[model samples]
Target: MTPPTLMSMMIAGGLIGLGLALLVIWFTPAQPDLNDAVKRLSNTSPHRPDAEASTVNGKERLGIWAMRTLPVGLWAKTPTRELALLRIPLARFYGDKLTYAALGFVIPIGLATFLSLLGLGLPFAMPVIACIALAVVMFFLPNYNAIDDAKKARIEFNRALGAYIDLVALERTNGSGVRQAMETAAGIGDSWVFNRLAEELNRSRWSGLPPWDALHALATELGLPDLDDFADIMRLSGEEGTATYATLRARSAAMRTAMLNDELTEANAIGERMSIPGSLLGVIFMAILLTPSLLRMIPG
Candidate 1:
C-alpha cells in the first residue's frame, strides 16, 4: 500500500484496539458503573448515605493490589457530580469516569513500559510525564468554559437592560406610575432579559417586597451598578412624584458610555501585554542576526 494508505490503516488499527479495550472494560463485572463512578468522582453528593463499600480481605487482596497499582486515587479525587452537571461531552469522549488528570499518571507509565518491551526508540518517561501534565490542565478547563458563558450572558443582559429602561421611561411619560410602567413594559417585552425581570418582579410582589427593591437586590447580586441606580431612582420617585424619567434616561446613557469606555481601556491593556512578548521576540531575533558579526568583530 501507499505511505498515506499505510498510515490510515495504522491509525484505524490503533482506534480499533482502543475500542476493544473500552469494550472489555465495559463488560468487566467488577468495573463500577461509569456514570456512578464519575458521579462519585465529581463529589456532588447531595445525599450520600453513611454506608461505605465493604472490602473483603481474603481473595479480594489480589484485586486490591491490582486497583492500587492503577491511578484509582486520581480517579476517586474527581468530583463526579459536578462533572455530570457541567455536561461537557468532551470529557466523556476520552473515557467516561476517566479524568485527563488520571490519564498522564495511568497512560504514559503503561505506554512507556509497553513501548520499551516492543523495543521502540521512544522517550518513555517524557511521554508519560507530558500526558500527566496535560491531564492536570484539562481537569480545570470546565471552570474557564463556565466563566466565558457567564460573561456572554451578562453582556447580553446588560444590552437588553438599557432598552428595557427606555421602554419603562416611555410608559411613565404616558401617565403610568413607576410600578405600573414596570408591569406594562415587562408584559410587552418577550425577550429572556425581560422575562427574567418579570419573574423577579412577580416574586417581589408575591413576597410583599417592592419591585424596585427586588431590582436593587438582583443588581447587587449581579454587581450591576446601573440597575441598582435605576432601582434607587424608582424608589425615590414613589415618594417625590413622577419627575425622575429624565434622570433615568440620562443615567442609562451615562452607564452605556461608561461600559464602552471600560471595554476600550481593557482592550488597550491587553494590547500592551501582548506587546511585551513581541518586544522580547524582537530582541532575541536581533541578537541571533548579529551573533556571527559580533563574534567575528570581537577578537582577531
Candidate 2:
C-alpha cells in the first residue's frame, strides 16, 4: 500500500477507537453502590452527604466507575467495617485507591521516557514489572491506611465509650431515664466520638426507632463489642425499667483496666524492640576495642 493510504487507514482506525471509547463511557450505567444501599435501608444510621450518588466527587466517581468496569475478583475486597468506623464513604475509598493506582501506572512510563531521553535504554520487562508492582502496592495502600486509621479510631472510641458509660451512670443516679442519660452524656463531650453518638441518637429519635437499636447497629457495623454491651445495657434499662448504675460502673471499670493492660503490654513490646539496636551497638563497640589486642596476640 502507498504511504499516504496507510496513513489514512491508521488515522481512521484511531478515530474509530476514540469514538468507541467515548460511547462506552457516556452510555454505561454506573453500578449501584452497596454501602449506600445498606445505609438507605437502615433509617436511623448516620449517612454522609457525599455518599449520595448525585453528590459524588470526580475522584469518587472514578473509583465507582473502575469498580463497575473491573472484575469483582480483580479488585480488593471492600473494607466495610473500617470505613464505617472512620465514616469514610466506600466511593471515596475506592477513589483514593484508584487515584493511587493511576499514579503508580503513570510513574513508570514517566521514568522510562526520561531514561530514553537520557540515552539509557531500559529492557522492555523493567517498566512493565515496575508498573505492575507499583500499581498493586498503590491500589492496596488505601486498605492499609484505612485499617490502621480504624485501629486507632477504635481505641479512641473505646476510651470515649468508657467515659460515656461513667457519665451515663452518673445521669442515671441523678434520676434520668436511659434515653435521657444517653442523650445527655452524648452531648457532654466535644470529641468526634461524642458527636457521632449524638448524631446517631438524634437520627434514631427522628426516625422513630429506639435509641438502643441504633447504638447496637452502629456497634455491629463498627465491630465494637463494648458499644454493643452498652447498647444491651441500655436496652435492659429501657425495657425493664431497671436501675443500671452498678452495671454501668462495673463495665466502665473493667474497660479502663483492659485498656491499661493493653497499653502496658504494647509498651513492653516496644521496649524489647528498642533494646536490640542498643545491644548490637554495644557488641560492635566491644569488638572494635578488642580487635588490636586479638591481632597482637596472634603469632605474626
Candidate 3:
C-alpha cells in the first residue's frame, strides 16, 4: 500500500477508537463509593468532578503533574492574553492540553495493537508518525478555543460598553461625581459585563486607586481599546473637570454605528460565500439539461 493510504487507515482507526471510547463513557454510570455512601448517610452531598469520569479526572491530574514537571517554556507559546481575557487558569489550560495530547498519543497505539491482534502488521513508523502529528494537533485545541471564546466575549463586552458609556453620561448629567457616576452606572446594568465593571470599580475603591486607572488597566489586560479610550475620557473628566456628557454620548453613538457596519459587512461576506454553491448547482443543472441535446446535434 502507498504511504498516504497507510496513514489514512491509521488515522481512521484512531478516530474509530476515539468514538468507541466516547460511547463507552456516555453509557457507563458512575458507581457509588464508600465516601458517597457516607455522605448520603450523613445527609451531606459528595463533591463531583466536572469531568465526565473519574478516569478523566485522573488524567487531568496527571496532566497537571506533568505540566509542573515540564518546563514552563514548553507551553509558553500558548494564548496567555486570550486566556486572561477568558479568566482561565494557566494550570487548567495546561491540564486540558495535556489530556488532549494523551488521548491523541494513546489512540494510535491502541489501534496498532488491535491491528496486530488481527494479524495485520503496520510499520512502526506509521503509527509513531501518526501519534506525534495528532498529539501536536490536539495540544493546540485549547489555544484555538481560548482565542475564539475571547473574541466572542470581547464583542459582547464592547456591545455592553456602548450602553455603559451612555449610562455613565446620564449619571454624570444628574450631578453625580465621576466615581459616583461610574459606580451607579455599573450597578444599573445586570449583565456580566456590568458585574465585571462593578468588581473592578470596587477593587479600585478598596485599593485607593482612581476608577479611570483601574478601567484603563482592565482595558489593557482584555485588549479593549474602546474601554481604554473611555478611561481616558473619564480621566479628563475627573482630573481636569471637563464636561464629558456630550463626548460620552458621541462616543457611544459612534461605537454603535461601527458595530452595525461590522455586522452588515459580515452578513454581506456570508451571502457572497453562500452564492458559490448555488451558482455551482445551477451550472450542473444546465449541463444535465443540455448534454443530450448537444450529443444529438453532433449526428453520431
Candidate 4:
C-alpha cells in the first residue's frame, strides 16, 4: 500500500509538471520588449549579430554556467543527446556552442513533454524528437564555422608575415645596418604585420631593449618560428654591423617557397581526404543499385 501510494504521488506530480510546461509552451505570452533588446545587443556585439540578448534563459548566463559545469552536466544528462553528442564529440570540442544548443533543445523538449501529458492538443513525441535533432545539428555547426575562421585568420597572418620579411630583407640588402633596416622596413610596411612589428620596435626602443630582442619576444608570443629565426639572424648581424643582403635575400626566397609548398601540400591532403568520402558514397550507391539482384541470388 505504501509503495503504491508513493507511485501514485509521483505520477500525479509528473502530470502537474507536464501541464504547467504545456501551458508555458503554448500560451505563455512573448516578452514585448525582447525584439528591442535583441536589436540593441545586435548593434553592439558583432560577435553575436544573430544572438538574442534575452531568451527565457539569458544566453550569457547559460553559456557561463554550462561551460563551468560541463563535466557535471555530461554526467547528469542521460538522453538521446548524450548518445548523439558523444558520438560527434561536439560537446568536448565545442562546449560553449553545444551547451547553448542543449539548453535550447531541452527547454523545448521539457515543454512538449509537459504539454502532452497535460492533454494539450499537440504532438509531443514528434516535436520533442525534432527539437533534439535540431539541437544536435546546431551543436556541431558553430564548431565547424569557428574552425574555418581560425584557419583563414592563420593563413592571412602567415601571408602578411612573409611580405613583411621580404621588405625587411630588401632594406637590409640596401646597406642599412640590421637595426636600421628593420626600422626602415617596418616604417615602409603597408600592412598590419609591419604595423605590429613597428609597435614592438617602439616599445623595445623606449625600454632600452635591442630591436632584435623585441622581434624575438614578439615571435615567441605569436608562435612564429620564421620571425624568430629572422630575429636571431638580425641579432647576429647587428653585432658588427655586418651586411647580410645575400643571406636575407636567400632566406626570404626560401620562406616564400616553403609557404607555397605548405599550401600545396595542404590542398593535396584535403583532396585526398575528400576522395575517401566520395569513394564510400559511390560504393554505397552501387550497393543500393545491386540490392535487388543480390537479393535474388539468395535463397529466401
- What is the RMSD of candidate 4? 11.8
What overall lDDT goes with each candidate model?
0.62, 0.82, 0.80, 0.60
lDDT of 2 by residue, 1-300 (tens): 753344345435644674575456545555667776786767655554323445666666666776677787866588889987887767678778877886786688667766765767577678779978998999999999999999999999999999999999999999987889999999999998998898889889989989999998888888999999999999999999877999999999999999999999999999999999999999999999999999999998
Stretches > 4 Å off in candidate 1: 1-136, 187-191, 206-208, 239-242, 273-289
Error of 2 at 38 (Å): 8.6
TM-score of each: 0.55, 0.83, 0.77, 0.53
Q: List residue ranges in candidate 4 displaced over 4 A.
A: 1-152
Worst 10 residues of 1 by lDDT: 43-52
Tens digit per residue, CA lDDT, model 1, 1-300: 653344335445654775575555545545334664564444322222222232222223323333545565643344333332233222242242233444444565456546555656354346546666866776555445555665666777777888888888898899997788888888788987787677677767766777788888767655566778888888888766758779878877886897799899999999999999999999999999999999999988
For candidate 4, what is the lDDT?
Answer: 0.60
Error of 1 at 152 (Å): 3.5
- Per-prediction tally of clashes: 12, 0, 0, 1
Which candidate, 1 or 3, has the higher TM-score? 3
**Per-residue lDDT value at 10 in model 4:** 51
Error of 1 at 45 (Å): 23
Cα lDDT tens digits for candidate 4, 186-250: 89866655766776777677667788888776656445677788887788788866566666777
